[model samples]
Target: MGMEQQAVEIVETNKPVILQGGCLCGAVRYQLSAKPFDADYCHCKQCQKSSGAVFQVWMDFKREQVTWLKGEVSEFESSDNVRRGFCKQCGCTLSYRDTRYPDYFTLTIGSLDEPSLIKPNYHIYTSNQVKWLSITDDCERYQQERTS
Candidate 1:
């Protein structure tokens, strides 16, 4: 079957699907036991700086759902309670975690083996988005992080 057909089958089956991904240098690899949720594009300054892009696409998963299949990521305390993970060997950004929400974990959409499987449902921190960037998507926009 084609890629689209395979994706549809995975969703229709309603079974736990493991998504695999890794860093640029292949030094770090991981797997998600469950499908990710709350996929969104973040335009926050932190995300822009960390990703070196106009915005960063991130998806949320439960901490328990993540497994380090290969090497572990080195974390940097980006903010008071927020830490970002990267592959030390290649310096590829991999994940994010906020100590305040220990149960939640986030992964960069670009790092996924099949990045097209996840789609951004909304945009966050739009207020900080670059002035030159124009987002025309119909997805919901939040001036900052979503409270609900």
Candidate 2:
């Protein structure tokens, strides 16, 4: 059978439907059972530093939806309110979690196996975006964290 057909069959079966991914060194693997929400580009300084980029694309999912399939991640309290998880072996940032929002996790889109399938719907903390870095997309832009 075709790959697409096999995927459909896997979904139709009672078997787990998971989106798999790992760190640069393949030491930390993960699985997501459900699609993420609130995909966006974050220009916050913390995101920029963690990703070593002008901005970071992140997607949110319920904490329960994620399952660690391989090596465990090393977590650091990036700030008083946020904790970031990454692969200690390769320093590949994987996720962000807020102390206030324990039920949700923010996963780095770049870490996904098929990142192109999930597009950022908006830009957040745009006020902190680098002056030289400009957004051309018509997607909604928020000067700070999105209220909605």
Candidate 3:
């Protein structure tokens, strides 16, 4: 699924806003109680391989904001800093976590029940994007991470 070009700022307050979603097979159900942040399209090679797509759209929410309401997920240590979570039954990418940000968990936007609520603000790792792929969006494109 393609994300909107507009950047969305999510601020989490004491009050929780429930965002419900799950896997394709309904084997994994979850709820996020806080606003999400850093929603972006990542063109990194690892993300392309993990999602089997040209790019992956991800959004970060506080670790405490997420509640797994149903089945457990299988995890793969994709890199020294990245651990990816997928539904065991459906083999759908569910979540992503980087060791550098232990307090946050990034979820695949395609798995969300309300994906339209969030929009990608930028493109990360644009240097690694597939040669055949052309990005036409007006969003900011970073050579690597946003910080870099």
Candidate 4:
């Protein structure tokens, strides 16, 4: 099953009026008011290349809720539907958005104001996951395309 069918979305909070996050060199920072709509791990080829790692963990929230608090970012248009934001100084990824999904943007889990609050509900593209690294938890795993 795909994420749309298997993943259960957790309702976000409205009362938490603030969340803080920053880049590696602290050159860029961001703030958000709404809780994440989805937190998941992606193991796609693009994610591997973008992060220089096996996978990427992300926390998605409303685009309107995110605010740049410290510095500006240089963006790259990844696709017709998505544009990525990163700090030019430290090359730290802050946020990303899909033109088709204009209402929300996904942030790297590491960029969370408090990293502890982010909880991944699923892992996508497990077919390409490194055998040496493992996830011991019970989150749902997709072998290939999430829609498969």
State the C-alpha lDDT per candidate.
0.84, 0.80, 0.84, 0.75
lDDT (tens digit, per residue) of candidate 2 on 27-96: 9998888777567889999999989999998877778988989999899998998899999999999988
Sorting all predicted structures by TM-score, with the top scorer first, yields: 1, 2, 3, 4
lDDT of 3 at 54: 91
Clashes of each: 0, 0, 0, 1
Q: For model 1, what is the alpha-carbon lDDT of residue 82? A: 92
1-148 per-residue lDDT for model 4 (tens digits): 1135334343365555356888888988888777676677888877787777888888777778788888887788876877877888888876667788777788887876567666788898888898898799899888875563
TM-score against truth, every candidate: 0.87, 0.85, 0.85, 0.81
Clash pairs detected, candidate 2 = none
Best by TM-score: 1
In candidate 4, the residue pairs with backbone N, CA or C atoms under 3 Å apart (3 or more residues apart, or in different chains) clash, namely 20-113
Question: Across residues 10-115, which tens digit of lDDT does each residue of candidate 1 receive?
Answer: 2333554468999999999999888775678999999999999989998888799999999999999999999999999999999999898898899998999878
Worst 10 residues of 2 by lDDT: 1-10
Clashing pairs in 1: none
- Better-scoring candidate (lDDT), 2 or 4: 2
Model 2 / residue 95 / CA error / Å: 0.5
**lDDT, residue 107, model 4:** 87
Model 4 accuracy (lDDT, Cα): 0.75
